[model samples]
Structure formats: C-alpha cells, structure tokens
Target: MASPKSAAIAALRRQLMMGDGLSPSPAPQVTRLGIAAIDAVLPWGGLPGGAIHEVTGPENDGAATGFCTTLLARLSAGTRPVLWVTAHDDLYAPGLAAFGLSPERLIVVRARRAAETFWTIEEALRCRSLAAVLGEVRGPSRTVARRLQLVARSSGVTAVLLRHDEDDAFANAITRWHVVSARRDDAAEDDSDARWRVDLVRCRGRIHGEEGYVARWFVEWRAATGDFGVVADLRDRPDRPAPARMAR
Candidate 1:
C-alpha cells in the first residue's frame, strides 16, 4: 500500500505544516485585573485578555459604577484611557471623581435601555485606544455574549458587563461577580482603607484569592499587586512612602 514517492511527499508535507503553521497558540497576553491578589489568583495572571467579565448585582449599589471606576483608575494610573458607557448619564460623574477618575478621560455614552447599552460596549471593545470598556447591561442573549467574547479576544481590553439582574446574567456569564461594600476594618487609625467583597460566583479558568469573599480598598496602590487585605492606609503603601502630593 505504500509507494516510496508518495510516502516521501507525505512526510515532507507534514514537516512543512509542522515547521511553518501547525503550532497552536494561546491568548497573546493575559494580564490580570492588575489588583494584587486578584492577578495572583487568576490562571494566566488575569482574566483571559479578551473575555467577558460579568459584574452582576441588585439595583444601583455603587457596585457597578464603583468597581468600574476603581479598575479603570488602576489602569489609567498605569497610562490607559477608560471608556465608560452607562445609562446613568451625569449622575455618575461626581461619583467617578470620588474614585480618582478624571471625567475628561472618560468617553461616556447614554443608553436608553439595556440592549442599547450592550451594543455600545461591543463597538468600543473593538477600538484599540481604550484600556477598558465598562457597560451597565442586563441579561444578554447567549449569542450576544458569545459574540462579545470574540471581540474581547481580539482586543486585549476587558469587556466588563454590569448585569442589572442576577438570575439570567449570572447563569450565562463565563465569569460572574457580585460586588458589595464589605464591612470597613476601622479598627485601624485612618478610615480611607475602605474594602469591598468581590464574590467570584463563576469563572472558566483558575482564579486566586478566596472565592466566597475577597477584600479590596480605595487606597492608592504602589505595586501592581498589593496586599488587598492588609488594611494599610493609602498613605503607607511602600510604593509612595512619602505624604501624597495632591495636584490642584
């Protein structure tokens, strides 16, 4: 059954394919949320680069805007522009400032309903300049989420969808989280060490930190990964040992 010439050609073809194009590859770069413990816990050091990260919660609990603002602040602090597409309009501007975000850096879009909000999110995710794109949306069809997943894969930025309701949204997301303000550890001197509990209800790959609950804060970060639970005042993080130099 074996012809010498045919066998030789087949072997050559296999070698060419293997040498030039048959090698498989994973995601280009998978960086974490850049939060200390969070990145440490994630498999690729972060959520898959182009993956949908679901933030689900009850009504407006500051969980939606708050998490997005802080995550973006961390990113922008590292030199990335954030695009926030929300239905809240101007009501969210001052709140964003409280999280150390410059409204100027935010590209805010007003969506009338949940569906429109998701549409805008997918479009911006396709853009290269944005560091992260956050959208306040509710349960989206599985097809839409899968499509968004593709856009996320192509763009390194995280596509964070704030699911307004938990029932369907949580069920369908690759990763779903319910964020709430955890009790403040005021036993310490300063109160700026506010912490929130990020509950990772579901994630496709390995994630670090405790799943039931994880503590994080409003403090300035010196390192890409800080002790999220250490209760250190923003003033004390070693990265910025000196008193904060606030800009006017």
Candidate 2:
C-alpha cells in the first residue's frame, strides 16, 4: 500500500503527465523504457519528458556509457537528432550503432573542458528541434543541475546526465538511476541478453518508506524484442565476500 504522501505525489504526477489538467496539445509525450516493472515504480507510467534524469555507474568501466547509449537509443526512436556533449572523445560510432543510434541521428560535441560540455548541454536542451540532450559530467553542483532541470522543463526535451561515479546530490533531477555490469548468468551463456544490475537510487515525486524506498532490479536486454526485462528482483540478494579494491 502506498502512503498518503505517495498517493498525493502520484496524483500530481498524473496531472502533470496529463498536461496539467488542461489541453493536451502542448504537453510532451512520455516515452516508456520498454520495461514493465521499472515503469510501474515510476511516478509516471513512463519516463516523463521535459525533465532531467541522471544515470551513474562505476567509474572508468564504461558501464555508464553503455547504459546511457541504451537509453538514448530508446529516446531517439523517432529518428530525432540527439546531441551528446562530452569532454572525452573516445565514443565509438560503431559501438553506438549496435545500440540502435545511427551516426546521422547523433551529433557529438567534444568539449575540451567540463564547463564547455555543460554549456553545450544546456544549449542543446533548450533546442526544441532536438529530442534529447545527454552530457557526461562529474561533481555537478546544485546550481548547475537546477539550471539544466529548468531548461528541460521549459523546452519539453529530455536531459540525461551521465555521471561516471556516485554523486546523487542533485535534488532537482526527477529520478536518479545507477547501473552496473552484473555477473553474467552462467546458465544463459548462449543467450543474447545483456544483464545489468540497476538501482533506482532516488525519485523526487514518490514518498518512500522510512528506509527511503530504494529499489534494485536485475534487468536484461532482450535483443529479439529490443527491450529491457526484469529477470530478477535483487533487493534481497545474499551477501558475499567483498572483493579486493582495485588500486587507482
């Protein structure tokens, strides 16, 4: 059962999702992540447009990039142009293609500095012509994050913040997601599914329990359907011996 506060948030979310109880002509459409279980937990049935979302994963492992690419592929399905702002120039065009983002639909802006990258991201977010704007940033301050959120709300474009490490201090983002490469399911070696351990670290509009309602999901990407499916609920996974920390 949802708490009263949670219910109220759901109602407000519905109103926003339904165009603020007014004409629906100007309201942006919501895009489903193609995953049922994940959608069910969101305040809106799907990812709401005109909002900022954050995705983070282990540092330097490319996990964050992989997750962001998958999300971009889904968000760019209408063949809309997507602007990706990053200081790193290591993005491989071929690898992105595997995730369904073609070079023609992707515009990459390589910034020499993080500040430049964020400026480009905000500019792209304000462009109504673009479907989505993604930025690879780190240690984003609340002020900068709030600005991005504001821009996204007014432009009806989705702004995705891809962080390489754990930093969930931005309260302005609608949702924060953490993704990591999971141990491969040994039994499914022959299968084509790409497995990931996903965490819903925080949400703005939902009232969580005393423990703050963090949810874990074992998600797998099914190539045949081109969608994500929940293979297991990992909230209660058994504890194991901690691995040695890798030297920096």
Candidate 3:
C-alpha cells in the first residue's frame, strides 16, 4: 500500500519523465551524452540515444576545450569509436594527446563548409558502429539543426553539436549546455584539485542544480613519468578509490 501523498508525487514525476520525449526509440547501448555533473543533470543520467545535443558559445580557447575533451573521453568509454567532424579543422592534437586518448578511438574528419559538415555528421550519426558524432559548424540554421536532430535520433548515436558562438540553434535540441571554465588552479600535478563549474542552462523537464554546480575533474596522471592524461573522473567520484594518504 502507498500513502496518498507519496503516490501522487510518484505519479507527477512519471508524467514529467514521460514529457521528456525519449529518443532512439529502442535506445542504443553505445550512446552516452557526457560525464560528471552532466550525466547527473539529465533525467536519463546521460544524453539520450539518437538525440541531438547543442554545445554553444564563443570560440575562446579552453572554454569549450576541456568539456569537449572530457565528453569525447567519456563517449570512448564504450566499444564504439567517436567521430569528430569539423568544418575548419580546429580539433587540437597536443591537448588530445595529453588526455591519454588512443588515436584509434577518435575519428577526426575535416569538412570545408557547414553544408558538408552537416552531411558528414548525419552520415556518422547513422553509422551503427559509431558511439557518438561531434558536429562543429560556424553558422547553421534552425531548419538544419532540426533536421540533424531528427537524423541523430533515428541513427541511434548521440549527436553532439559543437558550434562557434554564432552557430548553435536551440529549437530542436534534447539539451542545450553552456560550458565555461573559470578559476583554473595551477594543478602542477594530476592529483591536484581541478574544479569545473558547469551551468546547465536548459533542460526541458528536470531540475538542474542551481545555475552553477561543482563537478571535480579527476585528471589522469602518470605517477612514474610525471605526466598528465585526459580529465576523466569527477572529483570525489563515488567510484574512485580512497587515496592511500587518507587510509592511515
């Protein structure tokens, strides 16, 4: 037996979740939108399969780079390869290398124009072997975004739309994320604390943590070599083992 209040609350929550409009009808096992607080924000705990996600903002370096890298790394966690389609060839190699990502996991393809970029993105998203598709365009239209969103949802791969400040359109996206990196500490080593504050500007039916929430990045480190890899786990992540320093 369920209490009246508790039952009513459950019903309401179910309604909200249903209103979310599930994508990738059957849902692809390989699709995951992002990690960290990002996964925590969405009602699904990850980007829905076959749905389009819009990542917008200015092209100022490091602002979107960290998130992009982290997002890709998470996508690669699955067996499928992630495709990064760019219009201007802006993907960085050193940054990626430092992330400890194997080149075999990421496919970087360059396109000359927004039109071609969108097509490439659509094709990649349609590929059953792909885990996710990253589409970067300069200035795209509402119709175009809607079309891609439809294709993404039908293809069963998460379409991560990376755009310059002017390009991203909000009309047809499953989620719109605005990412900014602030107060970066000089973490000379990997174990140091690196805080990334993410603002989930828009999520259709669920509550996003205040405007900015704390998501700590667990940077990959080579203790023996004194080097850094990509930012992978969230700080104080439940899965991370307790530091040996804290045991005694």
Q: List TM-score per model, in order.
A: 0.66, 0.80, 0.69
Quote the positional error of residue 209 for candidate 2 in Å. Answer: 5.1
Per-residue lDDT of 99-157 in model 1, one digit per residue for the tens? 66777788878898867887888889899788778887767777777777667666656
Per residue, candidate 3 scores C-alpha lDDT tens digits across 132-221 of 788776656777776777667666677777766754346666567666544543555534333343445555554334323222333433
Q: For candidate 3, what is the total of clashing residue pairs? A: 3
User: To one decimal, what is the Cα RMSD in angstroms of model 3 from the true structure?
Assistant: 8.1
Candidate 3 global CA lDDT score: 0.60
RMSD of each: 12.3, 7.3, 8.1
Worst 10 residues of 1 by lDDT: 239-248
Please give the CA lDDT of all the candidate structures.
Answer: 0.59, 0.72, 0.60
Best by lDDT: 2
Residue 194 of model 3 has an lDDT of 37
List runs of model 3 lying over 4 Å from the truth. Answer: 1-21, 27-38, 166-169, 185-195, 207-248
> Deviation in angstroms for 5 in model 3?
9.0
On lDDT, who's better, 2 or 3? Answer: 2
lDDT of 2 by residue, 156-225 (tens): 8898888886655456677788888776555645374677877777665544433333566777766666
Each model's total of backbone clashes:
4, 0, 3
